[model samples]
Target: MSGRIDPEFLRFPFRRVADAALHRALEHGAQHAAFRFAHTLEASWRLRDGRPAGTRSTTTTGFGVRVLYDGVPGFAAATEVTAEAAASAAGRAVETALAARPLAVGRISLAPEPVHRDRTWIAPYERDPFDVPAGEITALLADYSGRLGSAVGVGHTDAMLQVARETTFYADTAGTSTLQQRVRVLPEFTAHREDPAGELVSLRTVAPSTGRGWEYLTGTGWDWDSELAELPMLLEEKAGAPAVEPGPRDLVISPTNLWLTLHESVGHATELDRALGHEAAFAGTSFATPDLLGRLWYGSPAMNVTADRTAEHGLATVGYDDEGVAAQRWDLVRAGVLTGFQTDRGSAARCGAVRSTGCSQAGAFDQQPLQRMPNVSLAADPAGPDTEGLIARVEDGLYVVGDGSWSIDSRRQDFQFTAQRFHRIRDGRLAGQVRGAAYRSTTKDFWRSLEAVGGPQTYLLCGAFHCGKGQPVQVAPAGHGSPSALFRGVDVVTTRGGAPW
Candidate 1:
């Protein structure tokens, strides 16, 4: 069942409504039409001082209509789930297309694709987190916080859990009908020790968001017991490690820390919208310009990156995108060269491609579908060595693990990232833990500096559940997988107030 697409979701009543809506739009002279019905539930839990601090749950449902007339596209949506409302939406969509005719640069055409109907998918998970008692979750987090914060020099400890379930029904005039259900859970905790004397250090769990369920909280994909046991000790060590001196040195970055780099540099840069300069507002744009698609050197020959829409446990995994295109996997960077772009149906046609990579999405039913990201990841070299082996190749360097404060320019180029913990390496061995360390580099220069990548054993799939973009500010969840990697002498800086304060 893992590789097979299930058709069970069409059994829901929403599918019937979607079918009728699509038919309604096409009957109204729409050259292309799509109907999307979505139901999403989100729950958030926060704990402070061995008790529940806050808890919130939100549920949203609606349907949208998209249409294409003689070379222009328009979209309209309604909260009402009636056939008449859908027809009205289709009518308004045509009006919008006419109004935007002058602004459209060229004929709006979509890449052609074969139709698939009655297909379905459900993200793999054991227990649904939404079904778990909210009180039980809060109690666990509160207990963990209380035990850790009670220690000396500990100022505060906080924990949170976020669970979401999304069910969607999509139908198009081309005879494709797809239904999907996915669940994602994010469990996180931060234990911070602060002193009024201006010293503070915090340690957080490394549990990234995943397409899982309640079992994730208990112990399905993560070992909550072990991570909690080590939080207090790690926090104490970080509090005492010597403040680092800024200088150039070799770097061995763990998968936990490298995932963010992949997200900013590779993930956003390859987005078809960013590449085409459509994301110029808050989401910025891309440095991987169209002219550099096949010629640019993105990284070292050891680097292999892919944009996957079907990765297991990936938050972005779906049966079909909002544009009614099936999911796919395509390369973004291969052997350091820019190989492909993450694209939607319209964007693919604009880019002279034959089909979409299925990167289209709408944050909610009220929003219009736009080019979005998938599970953009750096594939590990299975035949290579592990993290320890890579570290052993360096006589003098720093081993950076976990994530910390990060900053990247609007161009997704110049950036500086700090790590949760830094360990000094001398004579190919870990010497001591160091505090206040950061690394900075331009996007191109940084990736080109890749020295080696660890084997599969060192790979970790990590990502955030909230990647925001677009004018109305739609947030999407994405995943990035990578193995521990080594880089040659890179610019290392200490976060010890470089500017005169």
Candidate 2:
């Protein structure tokens, strides 16, 4: 029920329409012109205690015309899929750029990129969730929920599945054309138990979404059977777990929880636009500015971070960005030193970078491409220990697993993070679980305190499904890969008293 090509999307006369738009813009005295057609499909299915909760599937298809005229960039889009509409939009885009020429703060400039011709890339996956019948999916959700909800000490169960497929076609006047597609899936289930105090204690699956297909939930990527079987007992133990004592202690952070820490502290802080103060919205400007590049000690000597759009199965992986820059991998932090920043064509030109890192991303056809995030990862030490081995080294500490909630300043510096499960580690062994645990530290101090990192086997790719940015607020997916890491002398707090803001 799956195929490598999207016949429905290919059926559209996108090439004919894109050529029309490009021709129109060039004829209208435009210095540069590009046309893009994008189609996105999103599906979600949910169940609560073996009963249908909600289901939705949405499809968005549109085309946009962008032109560089009179030294400024302008963009226009239309839902209509026709050459005439695309040509009209091209003319309007050029007019808008001409009208705004007087108000433009600076003449637009782009970093040089080699022309890419007739390139196509599709993310590797075997099954399309869309191909599965709705009734079959519903039955699967119901069965998973029914098993959990009926378990001992488990009063409620919730499960959900979300999947997306994006198909795009881009053609520019400069002899660059690309057709690309990406598919991703997210599936999760949660088990809840009512404690004696009438409060609900819950635990959720550690596996989040990945750049895979329907096979992800069917034992291709994660083992649902083992997780479901063990969830009820874990929930029962956690419900009666004692509250953690607040103090400075050694901490072992699993990738499930550490990935979010990386996303907040390192990912957003390294966006070149955010650092330059050109754009500030969701997370605000960064503390890691151009002035500190190549000098700032971002972490311990054990730390090495890379921003890449070329990693296999990376959610941000792309063949080419909107600016026609090929995907690349660059160092953001190497041996604890700030080495690079995420850059698009504009940011690369401003920052004296020779080329864009291929990070220019647009969430949809209508949205202007922004210097967005890429798959930022903390590299694992080649010869380091595994998670269990790292845990065995701790005399007294807390092992944090699964992301819970996070609080960080606009600068992405000072932050506190909580986790879904915190186990007390004593004398090289896990004693039991602890409740109401959180770790608080400044971004710099936290990274600098890194004691050790686990080997590749302990690494995991984890991130949020959506990250919001821009004045109009556009969101795109982001990823962070990390190994189980150990940090020394971090302040652990009890969040039961309420948020320690």
TM-score, one value per model:
0.94, 0.97
- Candidate 2: stretches off by over 4 Å: 1-3, 498-501
Q: Residue by residue across 215-304, what tens digits does model 2's lDDT show?
A: 887788678888888889889889988889899989999999999999999999999999998776566899999999999999999899
Q: Give me the runs in candidate 1 sitting further than 4 Å from their true place.
A: 1-13, 150-153, 195-198, 498-501
Q: Highest lDDT among the candidates is held by which one?
A: 2
Q: What RMSD, rounded to one decimal, does every model reach?
A: 2.7, 1.9
Candidate 1 residue lDDT tens string, 1-501: 232222333344565566666676676677898888887889999887566788899988788888887788888888777767777887888778878888987887889888988887888888777667766777777877777777666678888888888888888888888778888888878888753346677888887789887877778778887887787887877777777767888999998899988888889988887888888887588899888988999999988899999998998988789988888999989999999999999889998998999999999988988898899998888887988899899988999988788898888899999988898999899987788789999988988999789889988888879888888899889988999999988899878885311
Best by TM-score: 2
Q: Estimate the lDDT of model 1.
A: 0.83
Report clashes for each candidate as comma-separated counts: 1, 0
The CA lDDT of each predicted structure is 0.83, 0.89
Pairs that clash in candidate 2: none
